[model samples]
Each structure stands twice: as structure tokens, then as C-alpha cells.
Target chain A: MSTVSTSIAPAAAPARTSAPADNTSFSVDFSDIGRSFTAKPERGAARGSTVAPRPVLRDVSLTVQPGEVLAILGTSGCGKSTLLRIAGGLDEPSTGSIRIDGSPLNGIDARCAVGFQEPRLLPWRTIADNVALGLPRRIGRAEGKSRVAALLELVGLTSFADHRPRAVSGGMAQRASLARALARNPGVLLLDEPFGALDALTRLKMQDLLLDVHAAAPTTILLVTHDVDEALQLADRIILLGADDDADDMAGGRTGATIVQELVVPGGRPRDRGSAELAELRGRLLAGLGIDRHGQARGVAATHTIPHFPY
Target chain B: MTQTQIPKPGTAAAVRPARRPIRLTSRRGFVIFGGALLPLAILLVWQLSITLGVVSVSQLPSPAMVFLAAIDLYERGQLTLYVAISTQRVLIGFAIGASLGVAAGALVGLSRGANVLLSPTLGAIRAVPSLAWVPLLLLWLGFGEQSKITLVAIGAFFPVYTTVSLALRHVDQHLVEAGRAFGLGGIRLFTAVQLPAVIPSVISGLRLALAQAWLFLVAAELLGASMGLGFLLSESGGNGRIDRIILAIVLLAVIGKITDAVVGIFEKWANKKWA
Candidate 1:
């Protein structure tokens, strides 16, 4: 009963699959995304608690343009997620306003869909059903069924539609999760280390797939990652987090900490990892992290700079 | 504009549409249901032994005699009437028990207050077997159909209740979070997400309740019913008509098996439809 097909093959949805829309416009916007934690950075509670509150991000501000893939590069702790949460409208900014498409965001809900490191699929449903989970449940049965089938098509998973999530490989499962998030037809896609949990080969495939989908949909994406090459290869502009020479650093013995260094990728679309431009970007990034040519830090980046990551 | 369209994959080639319910319930299904040939061959051996006077005719009637009695009962519509009566009782008792049990189970499973308040009484009831309630039920309801229905209800109740509640308890938390993330709230969460999530458990409970009802109905009917299959079994035993007793036993086996098959198919259908 749905005769809503358009002349352009922009993809149909009273049929299947969901993704970003061009006419439904938005570019990422944020002003002040802060999260605070009161920690006693002491060995023991001294004299009934000499602990103080810390502002992870004092008043972070950022804005991204349409078609731009903004990569937020931060160490394990520099409030990247907090900034993303505010930008995505999933969490309220501590003190400033956030607007996407010139409209203010208020609360828990956001206009964007995010892919977490974990592909949190519903175990009870099949891969196809999981992808279609975001489709409206109250629609007519015929419309709903067709939409589900179509969503499966876009995700490159029409074959595994009947297979449960547990029955699939991790990469395949994440693909399904991406499809599920895309089903919301968001204007912006937030990816929080979506490839952080994948193997190298599969992660490359996913990155390529993401690039293809981005080309097709033109969604403004904000990718959060700890990998420098990943940021350099994929981002239109990268925001570095850690060192802040503008402030006093001797208090906690943090000499050269994570700092924001915006680097333009010089070209659009997914790039080859070892290009000369990438090498230049990597050198710039390593310089930002305060690591010497020998890969040793010139000084402690920060006390919080962990020696070795278990991953 | 340059573009490339990659076709997605699927399994559509060898898939054949099946006739919905007939495969499960046609006449051919009854012909060899549960290796009937082997059981029939055993009955033939029994008949041969009887003819050779291996055991007293008074102790056991030949299979042929049981078959003739079954035919007679069928002709008089007594078999039909009894099957209908038992089926009705089972259905009615199942309705009461499953609905109430599922409701109570869901409440107990989802709400801390309900679990804390109602667990003691439910645990006590579940601990006792349905047979133990026969005498008490007879004394309370006076050998009427209520006693039998109540017994069936008890048999059906505990299994469904336990399964549904346990199913609710074990639902994947991510799915629940997804439901919440979708902006589903209030009654919508329970109806759309929680209830559907717990369906496999409910179906398992329903199948269990069906099996229990068939097995328990006979014992429940022992409390002096006038015209149920259990009553007929009692009367046949009293008269020592071994053939009629054997026929009743065969009838119970067939009825229980048929009901169980129906419920199993239903559970499968439910999974496919809602899932």
C-alpha cells in the first residue's frame, strides 16, 4: 500500500533499512560538555577527606560542518565521550547550549544514532529482526515486514536475516548493529570506537563500509577513537586532547599532557594509511603527545598517562 | 552521477512453501504415530498367547476384545462424549490456571514487592504434588467436576507460573534497554517488550501444563465422578472388564499424545509469528 517511491534511488523506507537524510539537515554543534568527578587523588583519605572535585572538561566547545567526519582524539581520559554526549544530545552540557540544524537540544534523546564498541543486539531476535528493531512496531503488518526486509538489504545482510545474533561472528554482528542504528535515519552518526573491538582485517572492511555508506548518505559523523592512524585516515579534521601549556601543569606533576591539535586530512573519503600526508599527520600527532623521535615521552604527558594499555 | 548497486544475499531458491497445519495433523500422521506398528505387533503377540491359553481369560481380555469394545463405545457415541467432556474440562482448567499463573508469575518476577510478599505461599503450593490435593479437594467440593477441574488447575498452574516468571527474570537486559531507548514506556514496555520477550518461557509452560493436565485428570477423576473417562476407568476396573479397562488406557494415551502434539505445534507457530 506504500507507493512512496521517489524518482531518485535515495533508497526507500516504508520498505527497509534506515540511514542519514540530506533534506533532513544538521551539522554537529556543542558548547560546554562537562562531567565532574570528586576523587581523593591521595593514597589514603587524609584527615577525614582532603579530596577535591575535578572538572574533566572545564567548558569544552566544538562545532562540525556538514559532510565533515570529525575525529575526537583523546587518551583514555580527556572527556572525549562527554563532549560527544553533549554534541549528540544524549547528555545535557553542564553550562552551555548545543544546537544541531539551528535547534537547541534538551535531554536524553538525540537526533543521531551511535554505534558503541559492543554490538548490543537483542539476543531473542534474528539478525534481520535486530536490524529492524528500530522500525515502528505499530505500523501495518505489511508495511512493517517490507521495511524489515529492505533494512536487511541495505546492511548487506539479507542472507543472515533469520540467524540469531549469537550465531554470527563478531564483525557480522557489528555490521548488523550499524544497520540497526542506521534504521533511525539520523542526520548525524556517532561512532564511539566502533572498530575498537574488531580484528585488523575485519576492522579495515568495516572502515571501508562506513566510508561507502557515508558517501551514499552524506551524514555528518563524529568518530571517537584512541588510534592516531585511524583518526588521520578517516577524519576531515581531528581534535586533539591532552596537553594544555596555557595552564599550570606542575601541580600534579603533569608536564606535557594531551592537547587539542586540529589537523585537516587534506582530502575527503577513506585514505590509504601510509600516505605521505598520513605520515605527516602522525608526526604532528606524536609531537602533540610530547613523545620524542625515539617514541619516548620528552616528559610525562600527564600523571594519568597510563604506562601500558592492556588492550 | 556515478553509482554502483550491490545486491544483498538471501536464501530464496530451495525454499518451498508448506501446507500450514495438515502436515502435522493429517490421517497419515496417525498411521505410524509413535511407532504404532511395533505396538500393534506386540498386541498381536498378546492375542496369540491368549488363544493358546497361556494366561487365564479372566485376568486379561484379548486385544481383539478391547478393539470390539472400543468399536461399540464409538457406535454409541460414548467415546466421543467422554473425549469432549475431558477436553472441555482440560481447556477450562487450563484457561483459569495459565492466565492467573502467568499474571502472578510476571508480577513476582518483575516487582520486588510482589516477590517478597507472595513467594512463601507460592513456594508452599508448588512443593505439593497435585495428587496430594485430591482428598482435600473431594472433601471441599464433594466429588463433583469442581474437584477434577481444581486438580487439573493445580497441575497446570505451577509449571506455567514457574516457567513464565523464570523467563521474565532471565530476559536480556540489553533488549530491555533497547525498548527504553526507543522511548517505549508505561504499559507499552510490558506489553510490547517484556511480554513478548518472555514468550518462549510461556510456551514452554503451556506445553508443560498440557502434559500435566492429561496425566493428572485421570487421578483427579478417581474421586467418584459420574461419567468422565476416569469414572469409566474406575467402573471398568470394578466390573473386571479387562478389555474395557485396556481400551480406556489406550484412549488416555492417544488423547494425551494428540493434545501434546497440538500444543507443541502451537508453540512453534507462536515463535515464528511473534519473533
Candidate 2:
């Protein structure tokens, strides 16, 4: 593993230092984005019975600058993935529009590439072939080949290029999926819990690898994750999404989740995991998600009682 | 020797039996021998029944008599011609039917509009019995190779179409979405994601269609043909040549199995590469 990282270090260096300063990354702007899904009718229910549409996200608006790593943190079913999907053009918002690099986003935008929570690699194709699938259609054969090789090298998957998705471990497959998303050299990278399915140790390593990739390519990244510490460690800014406090009392209780809090993480890339500032922010972010830092609500003093051992 | 000491050459430890590798060819030979046991026993019983006069030779000829019939036909050069014609018809009809099946299947599988427009009619057509079309085919194409080949083609079409379409419909939706997210659509999506995903099912469908081809082949030949195994069976039956009839039946069984085995090889290769 040390040898693998050493090999990747040099490849990432040249792209960062030697490439001309012409920025390839694009800013993403979301204006009043909202999405609603009609509740699926119950099985054997009366035909033509109308089910009310369930609001998932409403009035979400944010702008991510080019080269920024913005983490959208939320609880499950809070539409963080939905927001990322909207940014990548995988899903469209019903109420508002998105613009990438000042241009209105259309269906399946070519300027953005997505890495799903699952690796989502084509099982039949080799890792290299799967990455090559992300190459732009107009790319020349030679350029596409070299681009795929560079991406495999950057992700430390050079040796496993010919292996299929099922033949590799989950971490390796996710790396291949990341390489595939990078192969497009997109202006914006939308990662929806790309490391969520990995083991804890692998997830940490993948987070470092993602930072390395961002440094090398310098593209705007919108990451959706539930891990508060992950957001603290990776993002330059974090946005918390959830339903408002009085959402139930507003307009027949049909209110959807919206941006509740936004904070600019106070540190540079590769922030210390154990730093006091990040720990405080982690506590705050977790509290926003309805989890108490010490298993008790804020503004309450707790008395510690030691367990009496019979021995 | 001490526990840490390495074993020297010719010592008991050094000479201990190495793990034996399983010989694939020998295992395959065992399987083949095992499979042939029942047929050999049947052959033995058949010969014994003739010797014991348990059945009349006119009704059920002995194995030797069937062998003699084969030899008699071989000498006249008609046996080779019959086998060759039957095989040719099956191959041609299978190829045509399978090609049409894939084309129709892909259309129906990929496009919801196409599925809605074509599936009902095709399903109804598939429900018609294999022999039911014989009269209409005869009337349309006459008593020639065309009618026989058409009948066989019709027999081979339905399975391939059904399996291919169903397999395509259930292909991993996540993989399809990933392909779309990477800017693939239409023909590109089908080739890169959908086609390879369904290859195993398509090969299995082909195997079924090949078997169906042979079935329709005999039907076509039995109804009307001058130079095939089915024709030989009918001709022999008309002349009360029980030996020739048994010969034709054996030939048909062997050839059908051979064709199926050929397709089985393809299925194995496809599964390894795609599945």
C-alpha cells in the first residue's frame, strides 16, 4: 500500500504543476431547487385513487464556486443525494433551475460526472474498459486510452486495470468508479456518498485519495454524505439540509426539506482529524442532525455516576 | 530430524506424495462412459429380445438389422444425402429465425412503444401449434424446400424472442443508469450495457431455438419432402420397411443431439465472457 501511494504521488504532481493555468472547473449554481415525488399507491388499493405528492426537497438554493469542495450533510431520506443528483443532471428539480459555468443545465449534462454511492461498475467490462466508458464521445481513440491509463494510475489501480468489478474488493471497485467519473474531465464532480459503502479504514484512505484527486484536477466537487467527521475533514464548506422546525404547521404540513444551516469549515485541505476546532464543528453538525454530542441535549448539565463494582 | 530442520532429498518427508491434480480429460471420459451405459444396455436387451423371439422382427427389427439397413442405404448413397439435406435445412432455417428473433426482441425490449405495438400480436402468433401452420405454409410456399424451411424457421423464432426480450427487460437498472450518466444513449447504451448483459440469455435462447429447429425439420419432412430424414421415415413406413424406419429415427436423434451440443459449447463460451 505504501508503494502504491508513492507511485501515485508523482503522477498527481505533474498534472497540478505542469498543466496550464486555464481552469477546467466550473461553478455550480442552484436557485430555489425543489423536488417532489408522488407517493406510490398501495398494492391492491382502489384504482384511480389519488395519492398526494410527497415533498422531498423544497426551496434549496446554493452556489458552489469553482475548485470548491462543498459537502452537503444530512440524515437519511433528507434529500442530500437528491441534491447531488440534481447538480449532476441525473435528476431534475421540479421547481427551479441549475447552471454550470453560467450556462443553464439540461438533461444529463456533459459538463458534470457522477460517482454514485455504489460503485456501479459494469460487471462484464474490465476496470479499464469501464473507465473508458466515461470518455467523451468525441475523444480520439489514442487520447481516450492515455486518459484512462492516467486515471487508473492516479487512483492507484494500474495493476487491476484488466480485472472485472466482481474480482476486486469494494474499495478497489469504488476507486475504479471514481476513475471512470474522472475520465470525463468534467467541470463538476458530483459524488453521492462515494465512500459511504467502504469500510471505515478504507473510507478514510479514500477521503485522502479524493483530496489528492481534487488537488490534481482542481474541479468543483459536490459531495453528499451523512458522516459529520467526513464533512469536517474534507469540505471547504458544509451545508446542512433538513425540514424546518415549524414545517408541520406550514400550509397543510406539506413542507419539504430545505437548507437549514451553512458553514465554511475553518481549515485548509488535509485538516487534522483530532483538531479541537473541527471537533467543535463536528458536534455542531451532529447536533443539527438531531444527535447530541454527549448523548444529552444542549443547555443541560449532566452528573456522572460511577458504576459500583461488587468486586 | 529436528522440527525446524528442512527435509532432505529422498527422505520420507521429501518423498511424501504430492497432491494429485484432477485430470479433466479423464473426468470427462468417465462422464461420457457413464452416459453411454444406459444406451448400451438397451441395445443389449434389444438384441436379446430378438434372439429370444419375444417380439417379431417385422414389428421391431433387431439392432443388427437396423445396422444392416444403414449399410444398405449408405451403399446406395441416399443416407449421406438425407443427413446432409436435413442438417442444411435446420442450419439455414435456424439462422434466419434467430436473426429475426434478435431483431424483433431488441426492438420490443428496448422501446416501450415497440413492446406495446408488437408483443400482443407476436404472443398470439407464438401460441399457434407448430403443425398448425403446415397447411397454410404448404398452400403459400408449395411442396418444396421453401415450405419446409419456413416451418422450421417459425418453430425456431418464439423461444429466442421470448427469452431475449424478458432478459433484456430485467437487466440491472443501475448499470443502465450509470451508462446514461456517462453520456451514453440509444445505440451506444444498448451495445455497451444492455447487449452484453443479455448475452447469456440470448445464447440459452439460441440453444432452445436450435432444438426447436430440428423438431420442425422432422415435421416439415414428414408432411412433404423427397430427400431428408423425415422423408426417409415416411417413405420407409409406406413401404413397410421397419428397418429403414428405425434407422431414420436413430439418425434424427443423434443429429439433433449433435446440433444441441454445438450450441451448448457456444453457451459455455458466452457465459464465461459475458455473464
Candidate 3:
């Protein structure tokens, strides 16, 4: 058992609503985001010629209502992670801009906390100390310690407080990562495939944990993932990036992803795991990726059904 | 069938459990005895060779004779004094060399400009043998304690420098990113993340440097030293006191092992704590 009292207020519980109640919730706005990297020209190019920039994302625009769970679904190399990074303020878009809570984001947005694909826990530090890392220096030591204890308890890892990360299992470490991210009490949480590395059982459990966490805090979430089921399971809205039809726009250069489909997931928390609507949404997401159950085009609505498999 | 059944009444089919054997000795006792076996065997062979007159007394002394020589030195208060002198010289040399090496390594590791400017020279210096420092140090510092200490210091420097720099450069990238996400930067990042990460590597380097320091102590004492084990060995050789020479060599080996064991314990503890 942790030294913290059980009455530490369950993480500022916000009512489950479509819109943020007031100024307490943070909103994210991505306006015409595009990113590119310059690639050197191959041999035999003309002298003094400027090489073209390889576009990873282009014309991506979206908005996350405060306290909404928005899952960005895309295949590999579709720049979903890059978009998340841009939103988190760890990266800058080559063009366009992002605004958080009606304020322009220039550097790291102190109100936003990011959980990466890897747990990224410091190996030398105890699990408790690693969780404490999320708190800013402004938080007093006693306060920070209590907050860390509360988080460890919330994550069901209070017993392992003194243990180093190497001593824990992978799923436990990922839970610790979640606890660390929440330590800042950020209004916006950005997760990049946080459960991608776990097994099937662990992934399902983690999804449930994420829902529990969101219910307790009601912070806005932006999750980037390739897993269709995961998006349908947790998201209030799903945004599909890098539609197959957009490839022609590049004309043999580099093609970037854009928001091709925006979906509003119906129903509420504790929804059926094998719900028919979720299965339909999963099918639709797969079809949006230009593949059907038989790996063929879905109906006659598909022209560029075969996504370009990058060599 | 009836006769066979009746015959089993005196002999029970189920055997009683065998009484446990009485304990003969503890495992540690056996381990110590096993460890001493090879040394005892070698001593026996050495004594037997001397008794059989296979080696002349002038050329090689028996184990008993060396024991007498050790006792003689101990009674004269010379053994402890010389050992103390040699130990102190090595300790001081190692302190200077190791501190400088670590400082230089860290500077090079943290700054690209420092690495580019200093690595070439340091690498070149590392290639120079420990024995090679004796002459230059003698010429520069003259025949005194300074030259001897410098030789040992040179021996201790290279390993620590190499290990520290390499470890610093190879800190896990993910850990750095994690630190940055938490608002750690600059010196705070280094202390909180990088320093602890490199401790295990630095410990290994210290162990290597300690061994090298011991190796160089003998060479260091070979230069114009009136005391210490190395000087004792040389002086005893000049006087054809083979027993004393053998005792010095044994003492050096035993001391080296003891020091290395101490560092080994530290290494194990650090690895368990940090790794």
C-alpha cells in the first residue's frame, strides 16, 4: 500500500461530454500541416540542381474537441506519428501551424504530455522515481511524492515502487509510462502506439485501462495507431490519413498523407466488445485503407484499391 | 500360493526409510580446502625438488627457506614498511591518473569539438607502453619519487579514459528522449540520466586501471628506489639472496589479487544496484 491517502481526488474527474466544459480542458487544432525532408539527388543529376523534398505529410487539417479521444488511423509510412509529434510540439511542420487552447504552439507545449511507443523508463531509476519525473519542479517535494504514490496506486503498481524498470514486466512498464505521462496532469495526452508492443491479452487490458484513465481524468487524447480494432474500441472520433487515392497527386515524387475520412463513433463506455457497429466501423476503416476481407477492392467504390507497397 | 503368502509375514514388503547420514562438514570448508590444494601441491613439489638436490640452493631456495627470509624481514620491521611505501605510491599515482583520465574523457565525450581535438593525441599516447614512460619520466623529473609515480600514473590513465569516453558516447538514445520529454536538459539531463547510466561502465574501467597500476608499481620502484617490494627484489637479486627475491615475488602476486578482489566486490555491487 502507498503512503498516500485514497482521498487524493480521482484525477479531476470531468463529465463525459462531446465538448469541453470550459477553460479547464485543452483543445488541439492542426491547420494545413505538411512536412517534408530534402533527399539528395541520385548520381547523373545536373550540376547545381536542387533535389526535391520528400513529402511525408501534406494538407492535413483536423481538430480535437476538448476531452475528446481522437484516433489517427494510418498504415506504415503514412506520417501519422509525424502528425502526432507536430501536435505534441516536439516537431514543427514545414508549413501550416498548430494551436492549443486557442494559443499558438511554438516549442514544447507544457500542457501536453506525450507517451511514446516505447516505455522509455530510465533503467537506473526506481519505478517511483520515474513516475516522479513527470512532475514539474514547481510542484513541492511532498506534493510530488504524494502525487507519485497516488499514480502508482492508480496503475496498480504501488508494491513495485522501489523496484527498477528492468525488474518489471513489459506491460507493467507501459503502465508506468502511462502513470508518468499523467503525472503532469496535462489536459492533452498524446500516445503513439502505446500498446503496440504488447501481446493480445495485454493490449485488450491496456485498452480497458486507457478507458478507465480517460473516465477518471477526461483529458483530450490523440492516439496514432495502425490497429483498426484499437481505434474503434477507444476513440470518440476516428481520422483516417493517407487515403489510397491521394497517390496520384504526387505524380512519382513523394506522396504525403491527408485526412481522407472523419468518423464519429457512436455509443458510449463499456460498449460490447464484439458489437456489430464496431465490426462495421472496422470494415469501413479497412476499406478506407483500400483493402477488403479478401484483399480485393470493396464493391465498385474502389478505383485505387491496391495501395502502393513501397519497395 | 498359500505357503508363499504365509512366508511374507516375517519380512515386510515396505522398507523403512533409511536414516539420514550425519553431516561431515560445511560447504565453505570444502571450498577453501579445494582452493588451497593446487598451491599446496606446488609447494610440495618445490620442497621435494630442493630436498632431492635437483636445484642448487644458490640458484633457487626451498619454500621453508623463503619462509625464513619472510620472517627475518618481518622481525626487522622492513616487510610492513616496504609494503606500505609501495602501496602508498600506487594509491597516489592511481588517484592522479584516474581523476585526470575521467575528467578528460568526460570533456571529450560531452563536446564534439573536444573529441575531435583531443582524441587523436590521447589515442597516440595510449599506444605507448607503460615501460616506455620510465625513461622519459626519469629524464624529465630526474631520479626521485616523481618519476616513479609518473610511471604508475601513466599505466593507470589509458584504460579509465577509454572506458569512460566509450560509455559516455553510447548512452541509450531512448533514455535521452524520455528525459527530454520530462523537461530535463543541459546539466540536469547529464546528472539525472547520463551520469547514472555510465556508472557501471566507469566501475569496470576503474577495475582495469587498478590492475594496470599494480603492474606498473614494480617498474616504477625499479628506478632509484631504496625501499618497496620492487627495490627489495632487485637488491636481493644483486646479493644472490634467492629466498628474499622469491618472497617479494609471492608478496606482489598475493597483494595484486587482494586488491583486485576488493574492486571485484564493488563491481558486483554496482552492477546489481544499477543494472
Minimum summed lDDT over a 10-residue window in model 2 chain B is located at B17-26
- Backbone clash pairs for candidate 2 read none
The most accurate candidate by TM-score is 2
TM-score between predicted and true chain B, model 1: 0.82
B147-217 in candidate 2: lDDT tens per residue?
99998899889889999999999999999999999999989899999999999999999999999999999
Give the winner by TM-score: 2 or 3: 2
Per-residue accuracy of model 2 over A1-311 as CA lDDT, tens digit each: 00111111222223333334323677788999998776884634433358766788999988877667889999999999988888877777879999987889999998899999999998889999999999988899998999899999999999999998999999999999999999888888999999988877788899999999988777778999988878878888899999998877856766889999999887567888768676667777878998766734342212212224441
For model 1, residues A1-311, the per-residue Cα lDDT tens digits are 11222211122112222332322425656666555444655533333355554556655567776556788888777777767665655445445677775677655344677676788787667887777766544557677677667767766789999998888999889998888777666666788888888877677778888877776666668898887777776777888877476665547733232336876677545676557656656767766766543433332222212324342
In order of appearance, the predictions have TM-scores of 0.67, 0.88, 0.84
Tell me the tens digit of each residue's lDDT in model 1 across B176-249: 65565554566877886788888877998999988888767888875557776887799888988788888888
DockQ for the candidates, in order = 0.13, 0.62, 0.43
Q: Least lDDT summed over 10 consecutive residues: which range in candidate 3 chain A?
A: A1-10
Model 3: how far residue B93 lies from native, Å: 1.6
Residue B232, model 1: Cα distance from true site in angstroms: 2.2
TM-score of chain B of each: 0.82, 0.91, 0.85
Judge candidate 2 against the unseen true structure and give its global Cα lDDT, from 0 to 1.
0.85
Q: Indicate whether candidate 1 or candidate 2 has the larger DockQ.
A: 2
Error of 2 at A133 (Å): 0.9
DockQ of 1: 0.13
